[model samples]
Structure formats: structure tokens, C-alpha cells
Target: MRYDLDTRNRALTLLRDGVSNAEVSRRLGIPSGTVAWWLHRDRARNGGLPGAHRSTCHTCHGDPLDRTAYGYLLGLYLGDGHIFQSGKHRVPNLTIACCEDWPGLIDAAEDAVRRVFPHNSPCRVRRVGCTYVKVYSKHLDCHFPQHGPGKKHTRHIQLAPWQREIVDEHPWELIRGLVHSDGCRITNWTTRRGKRYEYPRYFFTNVSDDIRRIYTDALDRVGIAWKETRRGSTPYNISVARRESVQVMDVHVGPKF
Candidate 1:
């Protein structure tokens, strides 16, 4: 199986910290052989290589971007992520607020940031209700060109052609990320003729129409049937209620963990 790039990087980090290959494998739920190979590759490549830095960013180093990780990160970005330029150096910090209810998503969001900015270690800050997974780098714009001033809903947000290509190639990863960020799987039930019936569906809610379009466009590419719905005052809810579509989602992007 092809493991996520973030998982590989994580294993390397733990190995460098002097953790044994067995411990790293146990902690990361990766194979012992895989962890050992990562450590071996790191030492072999650079004779005790130093940590990664922003200079290694694909935009600067001319390395191919980790498209699989980026595909998922794109969904998280459009759903509830933000970029803020702070501090005197004006380093942009990409922050994605993940609800505490889904601890799995919190970990997933942090992993995406780490893999995208491989050398940098992201930090998480806990708010009253959600945890903010944040990373600082100047090259964030190169990765997420949709970042700009003003609210996302008030401004126009569009993906670059290259980004669309990635989404096309890894449609399910994008959908999984988006659903994990802003969407949920829910069930509605009723009783009719002395029988109980339940309907399970998936809903993605966002204030930005363009962002919603991005989500739906990906769904179209994956052949998942969806329809527009409303939530309270916002008319930006997309629902996938068809039984067949739910089956596809169950196989690929089930409920948040």
C-alpha cells in the first residue's frame, strides 16, 4: 500500500528524535520495516541529513509538489481554513480550525500541513470549542493562490488550472478532505404504517458560493449525485442523499472520526 507522504515524514521525524524503529512504527501504526527503511534512506542520502527548511518548498527547490496531500489539503482549505500574515516578518500562517468533536480530523489536518511543509513542525492551539492547526511559511501563497484580503464569502475564490488537475486526479481524496472539514454524515428517521424508516445523507455547508461550486464540481467528477439545500439563512448547503451516492461515500469518505 502507498502510505501518505505525511506518514513517512512523521516516521522519519520520530526516528531522528532517537526513537527506535519499533517505537516509531508502533506510534505511527506503520510497519517496522517501513520505519527502518525511512531512517536508512535519510542517513544514506545525506550522512545524517539536517531537517527540512522552507527553502526546500517545491516552489523554490523546483521539486514536484506532493499532489496527493495537496489534493486533500485543498478541500480543507476551502472549507474552513484561513491564511494570515502576521508578525514583523509578515510570515503567513495557514490555520485550519478543526472541531474537537472529531479528533481524527484534527490529526489529519495537522498531518497535511506537515507533509506540505515537510520540514516544519506544525503546532496546535486549543480554543473553547475547536483546535487550530497552524503552520507558518512565506510560500503559502504559492500553494494556495486563493488567499486574499477580505472574507472568503465576500470575495471571489477560484482554483488555478493546475489545482483543478490535481483535484481531477485525486477526486476522492479531495472529497474526503472537504467532507471531513465542513461536511457530515447524518441520518433522519420517521415511522410510517407501523414501520420505521431511516434515511442517511451527507451535507456540505459553506458560505462562499464559489467554494460550494468547487465541492460540487469535484462531486460531479466522481459521479456522486448531489442537490442544493438550505441551512437556516444560508443557501449554500449541498446534500448527497441518493442511496448509491451514499454507498460510494461510505466506501471512500464516511463520517468524521
Candidate 2:
């Protein structure tokens, strides 16, 4: 095809953006066969298409703080690496230990914020040796009681409002059957016998009886065997004592009966 350099590059940009050759050909009034040839030639010369060659994974030698990649990463995390199914593991809240294990997790998180709001950038990413408990108080937990010593971690993903709305609207249509789970610590300090006291906490989820009943009914209809269970009014309930407390943390609902 004969065209100006700018026009040709524009077409190439479309291809880089994931438009297939057939679609590009139709849009640009070029033959599909010619588009295919150009794609092959571009790949041969530049190693790969623009975004294709650029590692989608932040861990793959790209800047962990790359906003665009991190925004996508946050979505993946919020979806618990997948959507609408049982998660392989529980979600965990932000912590020094978790960050250490993932290496550049903070960078990716910060990048996500920047990518979402390019004009208003804030440096929320930091390398802290201490965790929330250490910096704040031992009794501080985020939302639920599933936190603290001897408790399993709950993974929490920061979802944008729109993303949360989408998930909320299609509670059953989560594509991969899982969403990221995490933990948060909400500190409730106390004073005992004129001395300060701290307590570790944890959380668990209590779905509604209505939802459970519906689930069990669906299972029964599908000939699946499942034990019936009771439900509670609140999704998250907390049981507190002198030394410790526990709260509802995570809940998974799907139609895989």
C-alpha cells in the first residue's frame, strides 16, 4: 500500500492497540492481505507490536511503578486474580510482610494510582519495615476481625467505584470465579487498670440466610449434595473479648453447585 508516513504509522498504532488486521484493513480501506503483510513486516522489524512486546506483568523487568500496568494489576488483584469462582487462597490486607514477599507490590500499587489519575499524582508507595500493627496499635484491624497473630491473612484489593459497581451488579457473572481478598486492621484501643492494652484481631464473613437458602435450593434443584447452613443478618459480625476479637472477613458466592 502507498501512503504518507504519518498515515502508515497511525495504522501501525491501531494494530499495536490490538485491532486485528481485518478490522484495520476495513477501516483504512486497505486489503486484508496487505494488512497482514504489513503486520508481519512490522513484527519482523520491531521484534513485536507495541504493547504486545511490552511485558504486561510489572514483575517482568518493566517499571513496577508504571501507572498503566499497575491500574490493570489493581483490577486483576481486586478480581482476586479471577472472577466469580472460589479463590485459591484468602485475601490479605496491605502489610510489610506481604509487600516483602511480592517484592515490588507497592510500586505496582502506586503505579495504579498514577495511571488512574494522571493529573493528580500522589506518592502513596513507600518501603516500610514496620506493619500497621507495629506503627499503629496491636488491636487495630481494618474492617473485620480476621487479623493479628496466629490468624491467616485476608487479601484486600482497592477497587475503583466503577469496578465495584460492575462486580456488585453482576455478582454471579464474575468471569474467573474469584476476586482478590485481603485484610485490614481497625484498631480499637483500650485502657485496663489504668494501663494501655492492645489486642490482635481477625475477621470472617457471614452471608445472609436468604442467600444461603437460595444457594442450597439451587444445589438441590441441580441434584448436588450440600449440607444446609444457617445465615445471619449482618455480612460481617464481630465477637470481642478481653484479649482478642474476631469478625467476619471474606465471603464467596457463586453458582457452581
**Candidate that scores best on TM-score:** 1
**Residue lDDT tens for model 2, 1-257:** 47787767878899989998888988989888877877788897875655434322223333333333333433333322212112552323222222334334444444543453333333332446511111111111321122334322233223345443444444432321221123223445689899997754322122333323322333334333433322453433222222211221112221111
lDDT (CA) per prediction: 0.87, 0.38
User: Candidate 1 on 96-174: residue-level lDDT in tens?
Assistant: 9999999999999988887878866689999999999998887888888999998889899998988888998999888
Compared with the true structure, the alpha-carbon lDDT of candidate 2 equals 0.38
Output the number of the lDDT-best candidate: 1
RMSD of 2: 17.6
Candidate 2 residue runs with Cα over 4 Å from true position: 1-182, 190-196, 203-232, 235-257
